[model samples]
Each structure stands twice: as C-alpha cells, then as structure tokens.
Target: MKLSTNYLGTVYQFSTLKEVLAKANEEKSGDRLAGIAAETVQERIAAKEVLSNIMLGDIRENPLLNPEEDEVSRIIEGQVNERIYQSIKNWSVSELREYILHDDTTGEDLKRLSIGLNSEMIAAVAKIMSNLDLVHAANKIEILTKCNITIGQKGTLASRLQPNHPTDNVEGMIASLKEGLAYGIGDAVIGINPVDDSVESVKRLLHATHDFIQEWQIPSQNCVLAHVTAQMKAIKQGAPADMIFQSIAGTEAANRSFGITASMLEEANQLAKVHGTGTGPQRLYFETGQGSELSAEAHFGIDQMTLEARNYGFARFFDPFIVNTVVGFIGPEYLYNSKQVIRAGLEDHFMGKMHNIPMGVDICYTNHIKADQNDIEDLGVLLTAAGVNFIIATPMGDDCMLNYQSMSYHDVATLRQTLNKKPAPLFEEWLEKMGIFENGKLSKIAGDPTIFTR
Candidate 1:
C-alpha cells in the first residue's frame, strides 16, 4: 500500500497514502517525495512474500527453525526428568538430614526471571534485525530497526504499535490496522481489550485507541499482534496465595519484560504530562490460566488493573504465558514466565551455596516457540542439538529425565551433548544473545559456568 505522511502535531510526522500517491503522480514529482515513492514501489513488489513470512512467525534467516521448535520440547523433558531424578536421588538426603539436625548443604535459590530478552534490549535486536532487514527497508527507516540500541530509552527511541483485536477476529485486526495506517502507524499494531470491569470502560478504551491512531495518521507496519486480557476466576480456591505469589513473580516479570522499569513508567508519565496527555494511560494486567491452573476472578482482577492503567495512558502486558516468553503483549517478549519466576526465586534462595547463581538458569530451547504440548520433546531435542540455552519448561510436560525404556536415540544424544557443555549454556547463551558479558556478571547463567550446576 502507498503510505502518506503528515506532521502529527507534536507527536510524529508520517507519510500519508493520499499525499504520497498524489505526489508520486505529480508533474515530474518533487525531490523530497522521490525517496518515499521509490520505497513504496519496492514494498509493493515484495509485500506479499514478506507478509507471509511474518504470519508464519517462524522465519529464521538461518534454517534455524530446527532449533526454536525442536529444542524447546526436548529441553523441557530433560528438566522434568532431572527433577524426578533429583527427587529420587535426594530422597535419602531427607532422612539423613533429619538425623543430622542441621542441613549440610543449601538448596538452590531463585533470582528474578533469568534474563531473557527484554524491551531494554530491543535496540540492539532492532539493529541486528535491521542489518538483516527483518522489517522492510523503507519501513525500517522510521525507527531503530538499525544498529545497536541502548537500553531503557536512551538516545534511541521505540516506535510504539498496538495490536488490533476488535472482538478477536481477522477482520477486526485488519480494520484496526487499516484505520491505524490512516493514522500513521510506523512499526506495529498492539491489540488491546477495551472491555474491563464495566462495559463503558471497554467502549472508551476501544474508541480511544482508535482515536489515537486516527489522530497520528501515518502508515508503516511491524510487530502486529493482539492484546488479550480476560476476566476470569478460579472455581476451587483457598485464598490462592500460592498462585498469587506465582502471579506476583509473573506480574513483576511482565513489568520488566515490557522494558518497563519503575523509572520508565514514571518517565513516560512525566513525558505525557509535560506533553499535556491529560493524565497518561495507566494500564496494568494480572496473570490468569485455564483448566485448574487459574480462577476466573483472578483473571478479572488482572483485567481491572490493566483497565485502570489505560485510563492514564498506560498499557498492560498480559497474555497466555505457556512458556513465559512474554509473547503477544506490549510488555516483555522474554517468555518463560512461570518457570523463569520460580527459577529466579530458587536461584536467589541458593545464592551462596550454588556459587551464587540465580535460581533461574537458562535451558537450551532450539530458539522456537511451542504451538502445543506435544511438540515439547521435539523442541527440546532440537535445542540440545543446536545448543540454544535456557530451555524453560512447558505447563504440562514430563520432566527431562532419560526414561531408559522410553527414551529415544535423539533424546539420549541431546542429553549427552548437553551434559558435555556444562556448567550450562542457558546462562552463557542468554548472556551472549542478550549482549551481557562475563565481566563480573553474577547470575547463575552469568560469570563462570563452573560455579553453576544442575
């Protein structure tokens, strides 16, 4: 599509379709419009193929799909098995410790979620992807889809995009995008739930989101997704303290994932007020689960908080956290929520004993996402095969124990390889991938792997 641009008052300047197209057909066209016109022509040429790759969300510049998908499952299985084995191995210790009175060795500790990718790190990723031209060449121009980006909104800036989820359908998404394009969307669309607490809040939010885009009036597309936060409650409950703790870990994690530091929110708020945003949107969300895992009321509470946040120009980062990659929301795409949280906590608990490694260590996922529970084993194997680190387990998965009777050759090979690579690559790979170096770093995955172990 031919995109046009216009000055967004004090916010942004975008090229509009009408203006750009009319100019392209102008009498010998103007020089200022030449670059944009040419870019438009190129995008039209490749839009179809590019769009398809995007939908797949599986396009790796390298034939690396093998890793993201394959390694995830195997690594998870390994963890399950490891846990089982440890439970059995440590059984004798329980009795022995009882006799000893005092504990001889300490347990593992949890830290914050193992450092997965966060918004703070997007600039560098944008640079890498831009170098790879993950976004369209012309599209990449509007933002930092180039070069290394500094963390926490440094000299670099992030182009915010809301997902389009008008009643959860393709048409809704497309219509929202179309409307948003007219409003000057540069990088992506973030779909949000306009409904919460009261129906009126829903209407107001939806209208506001639309108005925000319509007001901006620019077109450039990237990172399209839906923002889904539902209201739900648990059927059988006992105060849900455990879930709440888990949820808090998850919630704090979501906050972190969105590149949201306590400082950042405050800054955004300040920026809004200074710019006269009339009390910026203050969105927030709570974590929820289906099956027996979550309560409906719990879900609703999360929605209420998220809803209130938006009233002040804030957004929530809530969504299905199967493996906690923090996917599908405005917050962290770091994923690995439940595991990372627990893992982080565990690492902190055992800081002194386990060489002070964060409880949350990276596992080797093949750099893939799990579409369902079944593919986990395959995903885990691929990760082990390719050596991606920090494989977080899926919700319903067998521990990563090598069932001699049921284990496959592939699984065996992967574990053996993984074993050889200890202390662990999850930490090393995450650090390397995240651009965190070993110059006195101290997470379980950081510093010397020698200090961290299973």
Candidate 2:
C-alpha cells in the first residue's frame, strides 16, 4: 500500500517502512551528523519497524473504523508513523535548530515529530531552542497564547480564572474573580465548571461574569462549564457567549461518555460563531486529559499519550480558541506519579502545539497522587519554557470544586517575574491604563480591599 500526506509544509510519500528508513539514512549521511554510531542508526531503524507494526494493529482495531475507510486509514497511519519515526530518529541538534530558525514546518508536522520523540529528547531539544523559536513554532501551528483569542501571534504568558462555588452562587463566584483579578491573574479568560449544569444556574453565572467584565471593563472572555446545548440555551436567553467549554476524548465512545458527539460539537461551533463575543474568529474552549479513554473503556489497546494526541485532531476541527489538556488532573489511576505526570504533560503540550492548537495545561495533581507543588512547579516552568499558551491559576494552587492542586496566582506571578513575561496584550494594556502595571512590571497592589465586603 502507498500513502501520501503533507507535513511541515512538505509533502511526503511512503510505500513501506523501509522507504521512510531509507530517507532517514539519506539525511543522516548527507548531513554527516556527528556522534551517531552505526549501531544507533540500525537500532533506530528497528524501532521504526516496531512502531509501524504497532500503528498498523491500532488502525485495524480502531473502534471508529468503517469497512469502507479502514484500509485507507490503516495505510495512512502506517505511513504517518513511519515518517514520524524517521523524522525524529535522524534529527541532529543542529538540524532541529535550523528547522526552528528557517524551516516552514507547521504545527501538524511538529506534533507528529513530537509524538514520535520521548520526554528526554523533548527536554534536550527544548534546551537548544530559543524562546522566539518556541513561540514561532507555536504560531506555525496557530496556537493562541493570549487570552484575548488572538491567533498566529506571540505575547506574554496567559492564565485562566477558575472560581468554583458550591451551590453555583453568583456572589461567591464574583468574590473569587475579584480576588484573582486583583492579583493580576485571569487576564487570559475567566472560565468556571458550574457545580450545576442546569441552564438557569449556568445562565446566572454567565450573566454575572459578563456583567462583571463590563462593569470593571475587564479585557477577557467568560465561559460556563456546562454542556454546549445548555450554554446555547443560556446564550439565547441573553447570557454572554464569550466561550463554550466541553471535555473531549479521542474515540467516539469516550466522547459519548461526556454526552458529546461530533454533530453536537458542530452545532455548538455554529452557535458560537453566530453569537460572536471575543476578538477573534475562534470561540470553542475544550479540555482533554490522558486517562479519559481508559476511564470510559475506549482505549482500544493504544497508549494513553497517543490517544490524547488523537483527541487534539478532533479538537482542531473546531478551530478552538483554547485546547487545554488537564494533565495530571485525572488521578493516579491514569498517570502513576510525578514522573509520569510530567512526561505526559510535556507530551500533551508538544502534541497540541505541534497541531497549532491554542494549548494550555492544568498542571495539577489529585489527592490520590504522590505528587506535590514542587512537581507542578517543575512541569509548569518546563512548559513555559516550551511556550505553552497558558495554565490554570487558582488560589494557592488548590481547586475547591475540582479537588485538585493546580498552578496558583503566586505561581503565575513567579513565572512572569522569573521569565520576564507579561500578560496578554489587551489585558496588559488595560492593566497599564488602570495603573496596575507600569513599564512592563506589575505594581504591588494590595489585595482587593472590598473583597471581604463583597
């Protein structure tokens, strides 16, 4: 069987794994890549063969496979896997640097190359890449790093507002938002997973957030974590439709577990487009995690990380404003510990950025996991270095409703101070206008004095 596809703006064709391996050999020989032993070259070829066979098996058993398309999909996946392995296996540090600097590689190709690399290789490559290169790669993939939903642009680090109220009370939510905003967080977007999924409850939250943004002139978007249908109802009822939120998985069955379908996503996307709110054309905000497939009994023998990347393809179809992978939020059942969590988070970010999706990570841990703030800090720093679009910023890193520890307001501040970063462009402008920021530095504003009164 033969297959063809475009990767990083380059068209590639493959008839067999050996053809891909031969290309790798050619590149290696042409570049005369230093320090690579002949034994290592042969080992990489063997690894490529192993990966191709595994992908072929995965395609054969894919639950989404239809009789009409299964053969074509199998052939395509085989070729894709072979190409990915070939690209990474022969990549030299200098070659990768050149690609980062001058190659017109797209996010899709980056994601394919990323998924083919291990965590160690990702870290090593990241060390050699400048922040500009990382940001440029993000743009090539069309990832939105700013909270204002700008595309194909790079700016300061962005964060989200995740305030949870036990009874979905509007007042409690407002108070939390006030505190977060006072600390210079929530500039990216303010989103909440409603304790109540009812349209009335979600609508109230949306209206309140919408009103708050208008009253305070906050330069951000608002989202209520209800089903797209319910959010659509709220939008029709005059609630703000800044962004629509949903949890997505790779396979149809896994997505079905969350009461979502591709058709439903399409309907929501159309509704959001009709009810324009943000500064950009994109409006969908999606969240995904690694173990969701297995939890929904939809793994189909594929590894969790690979399945997570596949989910991003489903997400990319919507031209989403943000595609956040809630890494380590699923608990120890999916990712065993900090090492596993860290690797998965990196993999998810790399894959998402490579796909040119506006990627964010909820660098978090569940109570059942044997991880701590230090682990989250390390992962957050690495992701920031890799130019991740954003991360969740909660009070003290603990999410009250979700029962997980994520990056905190202090963490965001620290990241900015340590990395000399700022907030999204519009938000930064707003902050400067409000005297909250001066000369690209955050002022030492005291906490909202009226937070307690509110």
Candidate 3:
C-alpha cells in the first residue's frame, strides 16, 4: 500500500498495513500512530478482514473508541498496573508508611507506577494506608492537601486569580481584581497575561496588581504573565516580583520558542528571591501541558504524555511555587476531544504529583473543541479527589483574552463544598476575619451574584 504519514512532524513510510500495525504495537508507540494505523487499515481492508484480524490476533480494541468503563479497565490492567499493585501489595502497612515517608526513591517510583492506575485505584490505595502514612505520602508527593502558604498572614488553599485582559489595560485589570477579590478568590496569586508584551506594559500591570493587593490589604500575591526577560526588566524597574511566570516545555528548543533558557529561569528565581514575595516555598510560577513539545515540533518521536512528564523534570529545577498543566488550552490539535483531554489532564496531574512537584491543573478547553463545562467539572472533581494542589479560577470560567473556558470562581466554591475543602490556611483566616467566611462556611458575600455582575 505504501502508506506514509506524519506523526509529530516525522514521516514514517510503511509498505503495507501490516507493517503500520506492527509499528503501532511497538513499545512506547504513540496513540496518534495507533489511531493512524486503525484508520488506514479500515480504509484499505474489507470489514470482514479487519474483523477477522481483530478476532484472531492479540490486537485489542482502541481504548479511545470504546466506552469509558472499558477504557478505564484497560488502563488499570495494563503494564504499569500490576507493577503498582505489586509494589504496594508487597509492603506491609508500616513498611509502606516508612517507604512513602522517608524513602524518596520508592516514593517517586510509586508515583511513576500510579501513572497507569485510575483515580479509583489511587483512592483505594489511599484508603488502605493509615492517616499518618497518607499525610506523609501526600507531602512527599507535594500534594497541597492541607499545607497552607502564608499569604496575608492567613492560611488558604493555594489558588490563582487568572484575570486575562484583552488590551493589557490597567483599569480593566483592576476591574477583574475587584470582581475576583469580592468573591473570596485569588488566594494563591492574582496573575494576568498582558495583551501587550512590552516592558512598560508589563511594568504597569505589575505595579497596578501590587498596588491593588496593598491598598485593599488583600493577602494574595500578583504577577504579570510576560516573558522571563520582560519580567526581569519589570523587576529591575522596581516592580513587585511576586511570582515570575513562564510557559515551559519538555525540550530545550521548545522552551526556546517561549524565550526561556535554564539560565534565564535560574536568574528569575534568584531575582524573585531578592525582590518578590517570599510567601511560599518557591518563587517561580510555571505552566505546562501535554503535546506542547510535539506542537512545538520538538517531541523527538516521544509520546505527548511522556514528553509532558519530562517537562516536569525541567520545571522541578526551579523549585516552583506552582506548576499547572494547562491541559486543554492548547486546543484540539493535540488533545482532540473530551476523552483525550480528561485522560491527559489526569496523567499530567498524576505525574506531577508523583514527581513531588507542586502540581495544579488549569481544567480548560477551547471553544473550537467538543468539550464543555460538564467535562471540566468531571475532570476537576477527579483531580480534587487526587489531591491536586490548585486550579485556575477565572471569571465565569471563560477568559475573553485567552479565548478559553476554565474553572470559574463558582466552580472552585462548588468543589470545596462538594469535598468539604477550604482555602489555604492563612487566606481562610483572612476570609473569616473579613466576614467573608463564617464558622468555616461561605458568608453572604461569597453568594452575592452582584459581584460577578458588577
């Protein structure tokens, strides 16, 4: 048949459908390749031939094409599954507790094993472990389940105020802040991606965000989502360096597209240490996602999810305050639909948590895709169950400037209620002091519809 196709910008030629199928079954083969093989074979071969082949060979149904239940079971029984089951099953309660708490190697290995298991299995394992062991394991995995960062002298769940402005206008940004703060959001940090990437524009936004926090006496941090170099300029210009932000990728070249170098990130880290808010464990704020390496043409034939995990390796170098896998923000080219998006989100979160990176997820989707708020809610709940550190709380879950829908402030409050979770410790205290929260419950202010309306 002489079928030639491109996967991640590399072209592979096969003389027949059988050769394509063989390559698709190779270890570490990408889902894209397998999808391509299936489509090509279906096109060239008769239905009976394909059905016969499927029935006779060890070829399994494409998990993506199957229903959710079957897909999950397939994953839990895959190669990484038994390794995880065996690893945890072989250890006694005390021994598992000791290894999770003190053995860094085993803790990380467990995280790797967890990549293959579903949320149900992960939760089941958590149930089996003791409270102390679970807490220590969560800490080792850098899960921000109960830890609070000191913001405004009150404890709060690490959260972000993502108020993206279309024109980088200072007034528009201030309006967004007023709205977000009015609703008891922005506990983690209030950061914006400026439409204008200029030094002066970034400096103006940074100063404005900082002044809003100070004038209102808010406990949250602020940042301008500019390049590291632009941020460096703002910092040198005396702008408040609360947290330096960047979009990092797995490969050096992919990161270069964003104008980030390892040295530059290190410099930003040092600069933040001197001039930024030292409220949290680390100062840098990084966002990554699956398939970004391939999207940037730097994947080197690696699968998107594996490439994403390698990006975490780069991110951990800076010891970031936050690392969010902006799961679906890259659009459908990389993650085609809700199923792919949800799975990628979980995989990225699980991998980051396992690596002990302070992991969060921007449960987001572009309007061009077959995804909606319901999908985000489903993935958000699952991520919460997995002890994800934080999520992007945008206004009404839609960012006009970024042109994507994300987790809204209302969504955050709903998840908290559903799971009986609260904000970061320091931020929660401030909320109570301000009467926004009463007796660990949301006060009237949190329910005021006028806040978003205004």
Give one digit per residue, the lDDT tens place, for model 2 in 1-454.
2234444454455444323322222112111222221234444444333323223222223323332533222322333345565645555444554664566765566655654543223323333344445555554553554334452235467888787777777877787887777667876679988888899988888888888888878888889988888998888887776888889886666877788887788888887777746555778889998778777876554345545766776676677888889988877777768877776777677667755577888899998887899998998887777677778898778888878899988788789778777778777777777666778776766245263244
- Top candidate, metric TM-score: 2
Cα lDDT tens digits for candidate 1, 1-454: 2222222232212243222222222111111222322235433323222221221111111121122433221222222223323332222212322221223321211111111111111111121121112111111111111111111111111122233242434444444444322221212122332223233333334344445434533221121111211111110111110000012221323333333333443443333234321221222222221111011121111211111111111111211111111211111122223232222212111211111111111222222322223233443333233322122221112222211111122232234344443212222233333232233132333222222122
Task: For each candidate, give its TM-score against the true structure.
Answer: 0.20, 0.74, 0.71
- What do the candidate models score in CA lDDT, each in turn? 0.23, 0.66, 0.63
Question: Candidate 2 — what's its lDDT?
Answer: 0.66
lDDT of 2 at 294: 77
Candidates 1 and 2 compared by TM-score, better number? 2
* Cand. 3 Cα-lDDT: 0.63
| Whole-structure CA lDDT of model 1 | 0.23
Scored by lDDT, the top model is 2
**32-104: candidate 3 lDDT, tens digit per residue:** 6424323443332332122222311111222211224332223223433455554454333234334445665
RMSD of 3: 11.3
Sort by TM-score, top down from the best? 2, 3, 1
Candidate 1 regions exceeding 4 Å error are 1-378, 381-389, 393-419, 422-454
